[model samples]
Target: MTPMIDVVFLLIIFFLVSSHLSRRENRMPVSLADSATGISETSPADDVFTLTMDAQARLFLNGSQLSTDVFSSRLPRDSTQTVRIRVDRSLAYEHLNRVLATLTDRGFQNVSIVTSPIAVSRP
Candidate 1:
């Protein structure tokens, strides 16, 4: 009887550890785009792939910096995959155009540019 209880305890510990590891492996963060208008009353969907660009032209995926080669390799090859690009307002047009071209070449036809909602200031 004691042996059976010990086995159950071990199984529980194993499952808990495995779950923790799985959750830690997926750390991608979704970035929201800026908009001149206010946020909608309804909440947006949580599932999305986000790409970020910084003022210095640094590129990131879910907050993790990635080179052009690395980014291209990691992109989903599926033609149906939806991609959202979040570029810093300070970034140059040339850089943004390059990224868009890369996505198009990689077969990601459905893509959206994200932006922040406009903030209303009280006079």
Candidate 2:
């Protein structure tokens, strides 16, 4: 009985350590684009991927910075996967265009752009 209890305890410790080491990726802060029609919305579906670009034109996926090529490599090769681009308004159109083009060329066709609702104040 003592040996069995020791084995179980070791197994539990091993699992706890491995779980911490293998945690899922984290998401970084991204300021969404402003939209007159957009309001508070539900979270994105699990199948949908989000790509973000900050004011400095840095690209991120789930919080980690990566190049466009590296980003594409991480995605599924098929066209069925959907992605959302949360680009900073301060970024240039050319930068956004390049991102769009790259995703399209890589066969990710069903992509959406995420935006926040513009707060309208009455004078």
Candidate 3:
């Protein structure tokens, strides 16, 4: 009876600590760009087009804000450009999907999501 009671108490404490840890992660900015096996290529400046999205689902292309209509126009119609898209985890999936659909329509087949490798934080 004593061993069973101790195990139950230990489990309760473990749950309490783990719950707090998860909440802490939520308090920070949510970014989906965390990857372990990301491509390690140093692409030429001219060949890479980076698309960034904020938590509010706002899209920016190379630091310039453009509407979806204008975005489609800016992309080269004939060139098969490799675009790297970095999206915040908090942003809506629909926003990213919309941009992907547009890119596919424009014949840009090589699209990659940019992400950072997850590393252990040592305190």
Q: 1-123, model 2: which lDDT tens digit per residue?
A: 999999999999998976654332224565666887743435445666777888887788767888877876877666777777888777888888888888888777778787877778879
Query: Which 10 consecutive residues of model 2 have the lowest summed lDDT?
Result: 20-29
Worst 10 residues of 3 by lDDT: 21-30
Number of colliding residue pairs in each model: 8, 0, 0
Q: Evaluate candidate 1 by giving its C-alpha RMSD to the native, one decimal.
A: 6.2
* Angstrom error at residue 32, model 1: 8.4
Which lDDT tens digits does candidate 3 get at residues 1-123?
A: 999999999999998987775344233343776675766747754576667777887777656577888888888665577787778976778999998999888788889886778875678
For candidate 3, the per-residue lDDT at 93 reads 83
In model 1, the runs with Cα more than 4 Å from the true position are: 1-34, 37-47, 119-123
Each model's lDDT = 0.71, 0.74, 0.74
Residue ranges of candidate 2 with Cα displaced over 4 Å: 1-27, 38-44, 119-123
Q: Candidate 1 on 59-117: residue-level lDDT in tens?
A: 87755789988988888767676676767677778998988999888877778776767
